[model samples]
Target: MACMEFTPEHRGTVRLEAREYGRSVLGAPLLYYPCRSACRLLVFAAIHGEEPETTFLLSRCLRAFDTNFEHVAFVLCANPDGATLGTRGNANGVDLNRNFATSNWNPAHVQSRSILESARDTLLSPGKAPGSEPETQALVALIESLKPESVIAMHSPIGCIDAPARTPLVERLQGTLNLPWKPDIGYPTPGSFGTWCSEHRVECITLELPRLAPELLFERYGESFARFLAAQD
Candidate 1:
């Protein structure tokens, strides 16, 4: 197929062929852009609604492409309800990050700081049970189906890349984003996708974008990010 033209003028109009992986609690469509070829990487963003910038930046980078990825799949907004509601959690007030069915999956409420400088004032349910939410279940199913070698779970305003080990992929991301890499996020993430990936033996890299304005992030990383994905193809 001819690659779709994706100039800035076509940004709003250009659309990728997205498949419905599942639905949210409010019946919002859980969408994902499947790779056109073998899937090597599964990159997801905006699992937390409050960090819409992750979605925005990924969307912008995607808009630069005219065709499906040759080896990379994408989930621009993993938590549509939360993104729409401008909350960190989904419609059920569950932190989707903490809802994964991992060995450390905790039923206890997850505490998150509202602002970087603020205390952990916000509390959210992990879920009725691990992988209980439809979104979480669907994502797990998708990962199983795709069998990607690695996954990039995008988050924001933390200004660092979080991974268990400094794999080649992590090193490339560190160079691409020009951000420091951390062994962990400096806190316990009981049921995080990273933890789930570890148990499943799939590599997961949490790409925590810096605390930059949306436009600035795009301005600095947009083209470079597009080129990075293209390199994977």
Candidate 2:
């Protein structure tokens, strides 16, 4: 694939249009930028609403091209309600990441730290049942439809390229973003999108961006990330 020529004008505006995949709990439309050819990779960001930088950085990367990719698809914001409300969870206060229907799906409430250095004092529901949230259900359906060989779930503040193995995709990302590759995030994540992907035999990579301001993240990785994605096409 040829390198995508960045349009400075498009930087100020979103050029690539999105198609609706599903709706959030608050009835907000869940949108994704579909590929122009058979999808080989699907990269989604903002599954956790509080980490809006994941969405921002991905959006900035998408703005580099006026059209969609030939093989790579994207979901700019997976949890719209949580993002709009600036909450970590959805309108139902359930952590969408923990709502996937995996065999290890737990009904117990999950605790998260207010900050990486803080204690795990904040609590969020894992949904009443597995895949209970509409966002999770819709995302699952979208994956089933696209049938991408690999899926990348974008998250923030952890700053690592996390996958079960350091495959070519992982190596490419590491070289592009200059982030360490970690086979695990050093914690068990039951019912996570990665876990769900593992169960369904889909390769899932968790790209955790370092703790930085959104603008800083874009400045640091925007062009390189866009180029990396373009290369994947």
Candidate 3:
């Protein structure tokens, strides 16, 4: 069943032992909550340090439960250094999401906007080489080891469910979140995790939460989202 009725005490009380997969540029441990049984899904948040909302919302959802889910592992924060520094990229100024060792990974600097409406005014490196960053390499290794049936990569502000294929999982997420499902985010993402998943034949779903404040987001979706996971199990 879904977690006991979520209460104020449960908001920050749910605990799970984290296994270290790797360390970040700042020596922060890359931690993941491993599932107790065979892993079928891996949910990760905060690949972009600037998007702490993703990490916050995922944490709130995970905290609703006291123990690990049987089929889902969790990465609460993929780029601790970036989150700490409040930069989109890691300490090395490389966007970790674009540092995956995929065929299309490139060394060219990437352009991102300051805000949703702003121009693409910021430039960041993809990395010295594909999988150059420790966080990227470690996450890749962990995913290969777990070999989950699907991965849910959390991001924010675009407010859509993005998957290359309109599979049932994506459809479910779209329906649950009341968001549109798109074939793409309408831009080229050369070295994204989604692209890497495609190369490895793994199903990936990008959940871009709406543009809402972290607490407000939790207030709106916390209970329903928790039940969604419980139903999955």
Candidate 4:
């Protein structure tokens, strides 16, 4: 594989193009940057609107490349409406992460902490049924279409690489990001994307970035992350 050069020009602007995979609850386009060849990995961010740092850091890494990746696809933001509204849940008030159509999908409300140290006081709906929200439905369809062997869902504040097994991809991420690997997030995530991927036999790794300002995260991990992504070929 050729070494990917991180051009300064693209760092200021995203030159790579994106295609629409679906629409959000607010009719905003749900976009993803497809790979040039068959996809082996699919990385997505910002399932929770409050975690915009996930999107920001991923975008910074992406802008380092001028062309499409050969085997890695990216979804910079999965819940646009929620991000727009600055709410953890989407416009429909559903936590998109808990809305996947997995066997453990629950119709009950899910509780999340306002901050890592705070109590789990914030309650968000997990949707009336499994995969009820449009964002969840579209993401499911997109994953099916891409058929990637692995998926990395980016989130933040609890800093660790969460996966069932320490596969090569997990090790690569652990090496590049310098985050500890945990088999679980220490809680039950019933209808989470990771669970969905487990049920479907696709490896899933959750990259929980450490709590930091957006610019700080980019400064710390952006370049290494871009190189890590470029090596996926």
Candidate 4: tens digits of C-alpha lDDT, residues 122-157: 999999999999999999999999999999999999
Off by over 4 Å in 4: 1-3
Work out the TM-score per prediction. 0.96, 0.98, 0.97, 0.97
Model 4: lDDT equals: 0.92
Cα lDDT for residue 108, candidate 3: 92
List the candidate 2 regions with Cα displacement exceeding 4 Å: none
> lDDT tens string, model 1, 1-233?
22434476757743668999999999999999998877899999999999999999889888866668778999999999999999999999999999999989988999999899999999999999989998899999999999999999999898999999999999988888799999999889999999999999999999988899999999988877777777766
Clashes of 4: 0
Please give, for residues 1-233, the per-residue lDDT of candidate 3 as tens digits: 33545778777655866899999999999999988888888999999999999988888888878888888889999999999999999999999889998999988999998999999999999999889999999999999999999999999899989998889888777767788888999998989999999999999999998999999988887767777767666
On lDDT, the leading prediction is 2
Clashing pairs in 3: none
- What's the ranking of the predictions by TM-score, best on top? 2, 4, 3, 1
User: Candidate 2 clashing pairs?
Assistant: none
Model 2 has how many clashing residue pairs? Answer: 0
Identify the superior model by lDDT, candidate 1 or candidate 3. 1
Worst 10 contiguous positions by lDDT, candidate 3: 1-10
